[model samples]
Target: MDLILRCLIFSLLHQSLYSKPYNIDGLLENGTGAIESLAKPLQDISTKDYSWAKGNQTCSQLLKDCKEFLDLLPSSSSWMLKPVLALGFLQVGCLTEQEPFFLDLIKDKNARTLFNIMAEQTNNSIHPTTTNSHKSQPDIQKHDLLRFNLESLSIDAQSISHHMHCSEIQQEQQDVLLKGSILRSHSSLQHAMDHCDRVGPVCAGVTSDTLGQFKSVARNGGYIIPHVGSKLWLHHCTAGLLRRRSTDPECHSEKELRIHNVMQWIPVVSGYYNAGSAIYYATQGCTAQAEDRAIDASIDLGYDALFTATGGVSGAVSAGVGMAVKPPLRDGVKSAINYFKAQWSG
Candidate 1:
């Protein structure tokens, strides 16, 4: 990797390594939205921003499935969806180029190193068949890393299904072990799972737990969230996305190819909207700063959407970022204000 890409990867990984997962299921308003119809599609495909919470689920059914989705996801398929979005989000290149992208990453061993770090985080105990956590293995390839993460995710998901709640102490031990695993040394975690602890206090006396805590639990249990290195992937893919098809420029139409390639990113955009809105709801009643942060989250998410739709770094940046971010940012601010006001009055 060149210095720019290396620095970008390290910066993103370090900044985002310990960030929280956003639980979209918890963002509903009294079971509103058509969640069931949406849920079926989201199972195989990622979602879009405008339709983030626009589910056809009635309040009653939304209450049922949203709760269930949050309670315990037995399948790792849901957990793996977010990473799929990440891959899609970073697809500045054609889909066919993905093999070489992974290949190039393997050449430098970064792919192996990154996955090994996740493998270190891999833990199991839910299903008898899924005990393997991908740890302590030798001579792993880049492709194996994500597959191992998926397996590990399956184990964690099954544990949730079985009600194997990992106490903070045990989670802490895992964190310490992961810390000492010699991955990246220089450090300060700006946000930890613990940092959001106070988010639960917002519901003191009225609710059993803070919205943030519940959402975080749902996130951890279900495994639906983004992680580091997507931006680098985005950067890498940008060239292919902007350039005409080299495979068979004459035979295969560029428009069709581009459409196929960009579709991968659309669902990820929905993922961002869903997750960001969840956080907005989670932190809305906490504080003004928290509320402001939620708005910021949506704006950040908008950038991801712009990347896929617009194509190329310059195109994404030059186009109206304000226009891109405005809708969600506005909605977030409105919701935050409305939520805290209702809480105080109640």
Candidate 2:
């Protein structure tokens, strides 16, 4: 071996020289002084960002640590430990192309070292009847390293999922607020329809029935409300068109009747009759049933109100993030659910 390669081998053997089944813990049974000692130099070297000059130094140090650790292991330990070792070397190799001379220490040896071990472990684990627990010899160090790599990947995936979820909720909130504003505007029109007298026919272009059409428009916009605790105002052409009834002042009936403009019913009815243009298109369908429309409108409005409120809370957390973060927090919750489906299958 070259002088550089020899030093690296010595560093690895320093950790395993004391044990046979290549017991990592048994080697450190009294204390973890040896592994720490090996890791410290590498850690110090790693702190410097890898570049052509610094990168070479760090790679050399890391290679020394990895090789010495590998050479000290018994033949049997290498069989089980190779895959994880290979993966670690793969990570190091990735680090190298980015740094080139930076990985000088283990540049040549890293992959070969890991691949050889991985091939050995693959051979040992392939027997159809082999039981994991019943394996001839257990190599804890290799098992531990493999677990570490898997855990690192898992953590990254989970972080992405969380960020995506937060973004979805914020979007849902904005949608709800937008829909609610539309509903409130519609409510004001409904108020006008109830209190204003008719200028012409019941379905006159700008008459009371115009409010009914607004309800239908709201539905097409994705608002859906449940049946619970719904409130709506009903409007209909009643039979008592001309008769005026005397109200007892003590009963305070005038206040209740004030919405109808009892004094000017004749003029109000005439305005609906002669209006030059229609305010809204008449639904050829039985469209005058304002109460029903109100109920449906109210339902849609409620849906929008609730949706935005809840969605807003969700969206603010994840807004402006990637689409990955937005959907689950709002209407895209179904998509988020699909992600879980894949996870569950795995």
In TM-score terms, which candidate is top? 1
TM-score of each: 0.19, 0.15
Evaluated at residue 137, the lDDT of candidate 2 is 16
The runs of at least 3 residues in candidate 2 whose Cα sits more than 4 Å from the true structure, single-residue gaps closed, are 1-22, 31-346
In terms of lDDT, the best-performing candidate is 1
lDDT of each: 0.25, 0.23
Local accuracy of candidate 2 as per-residue lDDT tens digits, 1-346: 4556544643343222211111122222433543342232222111211122122335445445545544543332232223233333333342433343334422333223323322232222221222234221111211111111121122122232222211100101111111211222234444434332232112111111222322211111221221223322212122222211122232222322231121111111111111100001011111122112211221111222222211212211111111010101111223333443353345
How much does each candidate deviate from the true structure in C-alpha RMSD? 24.4, 34.4
What is residue 217's positional error in candidate 2, in angstroms?
Answer: 49
lDDT of 1: 0.25
lDDT: worst 10-residue window of model 1:
231-240
The number of clashing residue pairs in each candidate reads 12, 33
